[model samples]
Target: MGNIVSCCSLDENKKYLNDDEILETFSNSEINEFKKRLKNNIQIVVLLQDGTKLPCNLQANFQEKTLCISCHQKVKNKND
Candidate 1:
């Protein structure tokens, strides 16, 4: 793993999206494109910490200003 982009916090048991950081990681336009794809209900893949690319559905919550990604299989860290 390069750097921990984002992770499911153990305490909250919630996935954290470093929106600002993620935007910086990729082009801002790319982020917007992802949003568009999500709006279209297109399935997308998210790269996990352990270098696993998982297929998931992107859910955007405007109110919360967050992206919720759901994958069918369980995701685990490489160390695990």
Candidate 2:
């Protein structure tokens, strides 16, 4: 699995993002690049502003070059 190259904080009340709101965090070019480099299943991670890292299964549409974080569990922060 590839590790995260960068991090961005998305401060929102919604813990889970719906399919339609997948592009909220990334741009078209970013998504395209991601899809192009995706050889197989990869680990999807969501990092909160409070330093909580949540692992989740993200749905990717290669043809559409889109990704969706439908759901994720709130895991305790390692620092805690």
Best by lDDT: 1
Tally clashing residue pairs in candidate 2: 0
User: Superposing all C-alpha atoms, what RMSD in Å does each candidate have to the true structure?
Assistant: 13.2, 15.2
Candidate 1 lDDT, 1-80, residue by residue in tens: 59996775475776677877656778779978977876656688888776788888877776688877778877774563
Model 1 stretches astray by more than 4 angstroms: 1-40, 75-80
**Total clashing pairs for each candidate:** 0, 0
Q: Count clashing residue pairs in model 1.
A: 0
- In order, the Cα lDDT scores of the candidates are 0.76, 0.69
- Candidate 2 per-residue lDDT, tens place, 1-80, comes to 78987787766875887887777788989987876555344567778788777786666676887776644575664663
Candidate number achieving the greatest TM-score relative to the actual structure: 1
